[model samples]
Target chain A: MAKPTSRADSSTASAATEAVLGRGAALRGRVQGHGNVRVEGKLEGDVAIDGCFAVAQGGEVVADVQAGSLDVDGALEGDVTVSGAVVVRAGARVVGVVRGATVSVEEGASFSGRIEAEFDMPPELGGKAAR
Target chain B: MAATVIAQGITIEGDLTADDEVVVQGTLRGKLSSRDRVSIDAGALVEADVTGASLSIGGQVTGNVTASDRVDLVAGGKLVGDVKAARLTIADGASFKGNVDMDV
Candidate 1:
């Protein structure tokens, strides 16, 4: 068994502003905040964060997510909107409509969703871009 | 380390169920049920019903609490609700206004 005091100290030292949903835990509701959040368990609801959001391996999320950035390596099933980049790593399973400034999907990942990335077109190609 | 930690600056408004240890240092406004230990650290705010095997409160809680093992309200903790546990302790400097049921 780990000491509570030591664990608290270490967690604070590592990610003082980040929130974590550790393994073996599950939440059913809404999570909204301005700090970074990482999930390694199960979450079913709506998530709206002003900072980065990540879903680690073994994690599962079923919700509508809005964040600054998103990193996924587990299972995600929802509509995602991010102001920054969205990276779907290998071994991830995602099914949703993703909208971000940039989207990158790694090999070996299972994705069944629509990706909309907003970017400016090169001048040589077109001076203005249309959706 | 606790299996689940609601770190500072985060707010969760729903139901949380954990099979292992859970530590809350932020805000929770719903229901919390854990099979293992539950810790409410200082500066944390909880406005929900809590159930766990054991619970340690060092923050502010405004709801009913049920513990199978024990419930410890440490110094600096503030609770305004009912408590149901086999063993309970309220340390000095802790503020509490609630009913206690020891099952007897």
Candidate 2:
């Protein structure tokens, strides 16, 4: 009876369904998944996920990343394409084109790339274009 | 635990180097190097050279394995590669076809 209960608890723990790349870890290749991921290490591959992605303070990524949302607190040297939002926190360094629905770079974050946010064309811009 | 888990349905193709433990339940097709334990859960498919402190295989592995501590091939596991470890154990129902180097 106690073992069954423990198994149930473990199953519930697995329900969190998030992947973690811990500190001192290095992954070089393609990472494709359906759940969110938090990186606290080094990743040198393309990542395509259906959930949010986060690069922790001590983490570094050198590959293109695609996710539902992205939060960076480390160094990223590749393009990023997100369906939701992209946030670059303080002390982060990102050097690549960023495309998202909403993108935010914190004050202390260093970013050297183009940002393409999807938005409807304003009426003034449309009028100017027509003229 | 704060170990890394390669959840089911996910596929990783490349080299993975970790200082912490790793549990794989998905598909991994590359090199796995860890300073801690590495576990291949049942139903997982791994085709990579593995180097770790300890290794527990309950799935299918098709590469060389080098463990500093020990290697355990659990029941229903299938391994088709050489093994280099200090200690090794093979369960009754496991299938293994490889040379084992225990360093004598």
Task: Give the CAPRI rating of model 2.
Answer: medium
Candidate 2: the clashing residue pairs are none
Q: Write the per-residue lDDT of candidate 2 for residues A12-129, one digit (tens) a residue.
A: 5445766778888999999996767778899998999867788999999999999889999999989899999999999799999999998999999999999999776657777333
| Residue B104 in candidate 1, Cα distance off native in Å | 2.1
* Predicted complex 1: CAPRI docking category: medium
DockQ of every predicted complex: 0.75, 0.74
User: Any residue pairs clashing in model 1, and if so which?
Assistant: none
Candidate 1: residue A50 lDDT (0-100):
72
**Alpha-carbon RMSD to native, per candidate:** 6.1, 6.0
> Model 2 over residues B1-97: C-alpha lDDT tens digits?
6567787656789999999999888789999999999999999999999999999999999999999999999999999999999899999999999
